[model samples]
Target chain A: MMQKRTIEIGVGVFVAAGIAALVMLAMKVSNLAAFTNQQGYEVTARFDNIGGLKERSAVTVAGVRIGRVKSIVFDDKDYEAVVTMNIESQHDRLPADTSASILTAGLLGEQYVALEPGGDEAFLKPGGDIKLTQSAIILEKMVGQFLFDKAAGGDGKKEEGAAP
Target chain B: MMGWLQRLGSTSLSVFERLGRGNLFLLRILAALPSLVLRPGLVIAQLYSVGVLSMTLIVISGLNVGMVLGLQGYNTLVDFGSEESLGQLVALSLVRELGPVVAALLFAGRAGSALTAEIGLMKATEQLSGMEMMAVDPLKRVVAPRFIAGIISMPLLAAMFSAVGVLGGFFVGVGLLGVDSGAFWSQMQSKVDLYDDILNGVIKSIVFGCVAAWIAVFEGYDAVPNTEGVSRATTRTVVHTAFAVLGLDFILTALMFGDE
Candidate 1:
């Protein structure tokens, strides 16, 4: 009977743990979703190569994550990568001519979209597309460009190869 | 040189034997599935063992881990003149990687070995064989309940760990560090998404639970004769489960975060 009681106690502890965990998880899910929706307003950007960009990837300005990529679609009519981004509504004044570059964090880190706002007074409206987009810099292409730029320049150092 | 070669060969043979033993452990997991399904009470008991009792430890450890992350992250970000983004970094790092993996490792260390030791001692006593003689399947009675319990408990532990950890980060970054709570929360909410953080954490928990249980049950069943043998099996279960959990975490993280 004592042994039976031990088993019951053990089982009770286990069930209680499961209940506690479930409650915590449900709360987190609801809270996190609400938090994400607080400042995000949708905008679209076009990229020639979206490479490793996925839904929910970070969107940064000057290395600060101000938004996230909400969805990625391919436009058959233009044969371009159409990336829908959700910028925090608080950061609403990005200029119309802003250039979005597809960037990677490191040699093997996750990818993000980096926006470089242009010197223009006209701000992009929600759902408006940012026209200037830089494609992902393929590793092989960057390496090749490095070698090419080196060979083509003692003089070619005058113009730097494009920023990855 | 010849003597050294002989030593190498002997070590290699022992390693292969252990590998073979681990394979046999896989067989035990497969065998336990049916019994686990039929015996719901046992499953519940297992869950209680692995999950509920583990809460205090996970919470305490989780909070410390988060506090450390905030302190370290803030120092680095401040050096770079971007200290305001500390909340984003802390939230992303904890949710994306650290919280689930660390909690699972702790569980494997604490609970996995206990399961293995209990089973191994039972095997050493020949009671396991006694059950066999009575036409009872030990896998159904023992292994199934453990596997079921592990699967159920790990996610719950992970959830507690992540939530507690996040709160810890909040205290350090905003209250102690003097960062604005509103901006900190804003950065976290704007940058981190629900699905990316939660689904990944749950997936890691499930995988860790299965692997940890497998190690414990396998080592226990294959324990050699005598008390010393059972002791060795218990230790091996703890060490192997911890290693496998870490290894699998790397694989899962790579797949989830790779490319796009």
Candidate 2:
């Protein structure tokens, strides 16, 4: 009887713990899910590379996650990644000419789209496209570019123009 | 000189032998998977023991690791006059490398050894043989449940570790360290990507789970002639598994981050 009681208690504890873990998972998923139906000013941004950028990636302005990527589609004709993001309704005053930059989380981390609100007084409407967008700057390419530039212009000294 | 050469040769052969044994054992477990899965009661019980009971330690250790990381990273960054980057450094370190590996190591040390010893004792008592004679497959009855439990438990532990670690970092970095709370949170949000860190964590957990379960179950199953043998096997299991976990961490980190 004691053994049976212990076993019952153990099973109960395990079930409760598993339920708790599921609850936590549910909470986090729900938080992320809330972004799905959030009312926001929709804007499109085009990029040459959406490296590691997912559909639900955050759209941040000044490091605040005010929106999320709604969709990402390849523009076959333009050869660009067209990303549709939904800015929060509260921050709907972002100008039509705002620029977006694809930014890395850290040195070798995932990427997110960052929007820099423009100075224009004309507030961007829903379903508008951000005119300017910067693609992810490939780290290897940047390193290569740096080396080339350094070798070409040695010691930060300007050389006489010899090329015709 | 002869003795030294003999020792070296013996050690090399032993390493190969151990690897061969581990591989064979792994194949045995894989072969027994179907029957193991069919035993839901055993699987559920093992899950409770391995995963549910393991949460406390995972959380406590995780928090300390994160707190220490934040405190130390903050101090170092302050020395370099880049204190603003402390949050980024803390988050990156916790997520990318430290969280999953360290948590797994601790789990192996605690639960992994316990598992080996428990099963080893049972084997030593002839209970395993008794079950075998009673038409029960020990692999399915004994090993499979623990294996599945380990796999399921590891990820849950890792998730708890990551969450606690981040919270700990936040507490130390902002509340105790007196950095601007706004800047700290902003840096975390901007500089931490869920894809890289979280995904790596899940992958590592799965790998670690399999390795830990293999070590424990294998040690128990292969324990030799007597009580002392079982004890020795338990000790060896813990030590070997810990080293293996660290070694695998290095390999996994290299594979995961080599291109990046």
Candidate 3:
């Protein structure tokens, strides 16, 4: 009976440890526990094209992540991507004229919102909008435009050669 | 001229007959499952033998696989100048695929085969029959606890396997290979989502546990009362468990990640 009791306790301990490890792994992998319950205020930014910007993407100021993109919605009236950002309350003293841009990390990495603070005495409130916004740079569109210009130049050169 | 066709027809019929019988056995075990709550001691003993005993094997294999992933992932990512993504690659692969599948395979080989052999021996020795004759249902008294223990143990074991494997990856990536520790962990944290990757893997392990335990118990109960029959049943348990796990994995992956 003593041996059986010992075995039972051992099994119980083993199972508890397994569960604890699972919870830790989930917390570490998801990164939800880091910022989900953080006290923050929301601010809106409107962009012509949000590109691949996703909800939960980091919102960084001067290379430090202050919060995340809370949501991305399309405003039918303005035909723009209206992104809601939740910035930490600790960083709430940003100037009203701060500019927000959709920026990519590394060269081909994930997209984030980069904020550039401007010189202003007044601060933006929770519901305030950041009017100055830069949309994500679409690499494919830029490449296509470059190719089109090259093709047009080549055609003009052919026409000049024919005239000569 | 018709011999080959007759042989094929009979073989297919026998396969269906065996499948039907297996389902019936599973139903019987399910019926007996409620009796387990009354026999907590029996369940605990079985859990010890099946789950706790198997931990050493699961941990060792998990660690080794993680180390290999770190080494291979590092080598591959370095080519693309993305060695920083090594943690993400290792964690994602292990959590999504390797941890559950490999741990289930090992469980089937270790605890699963043992269950078959032990149950087979009891049947061959007429112990199950003796209990049946005494008005105790062998399915409840003998089979149900073991089955419940197996089903309970599997997900926990798989979780342990994944956790240990990640630690192993950290050791290899940071300690041995000189990879940035911060990059390895932070990248993994950012990339692996809770719902999309980790929870789905846990669900897979639960299904695998049910399938493997079901196969092990049924194979043992159905084995003929002889040495040769017991050995044959044990072999079939391992082979069928592997095939079922792999086939189910493919179906689950397609269902979970497939584009609508």
Candidate number achieving the greatest lDDT relative to the actual structure: 3
lDDT at B144, model 3: 91
Q: Provide the DockQ value for model 3.
A: 0.65
Query: What is the per-residue lDDT of model 2 for residues B11-73, given as tens digits with 9 covering 90 to 100?
Result: 999889988998898898788888865667787678767776787888889889889988998
Q: Give a tens-digit lDDT track for model 1, residues B39-158.
A: 677776666676666777888998998899889988898786666677778777776677778888888877788888888888988888988999988888877788677777777777
- Candidate 3 lDDT, tens digit per residue, B54-130? 99999999999999999999999888888889889989898889988999999999999999999999999999999
Give the residue spans of candidate 2 off by over 4 A: A1-164, B1-14, B80-85
Better of 2 and 3 by TM-score: 3
Model 2, residue A155: C-alpha shift (Å): 22
List TM-scores for all candidates, in order: 0.69, 0.69, 0.93
What tier of docking accuracy does candidate 3 attain? medium
Itemize residue pairs with steric clashes in candidate 3: none
DockQ score for candidate 1? 0.22
lDDT of 2 at A47: 92
Pairs with backbone N, CA or C atoms under 3 Å apart (clashes), candidate 2:
none
Quality of model 1 by C-alpha lDDT: 0.79
- Kindly report the docking quality category of candidate 1: incorrect
Alpha-carbon interface RMSD for all candidates, in angstroms: 3.6, 4.8, 1.1
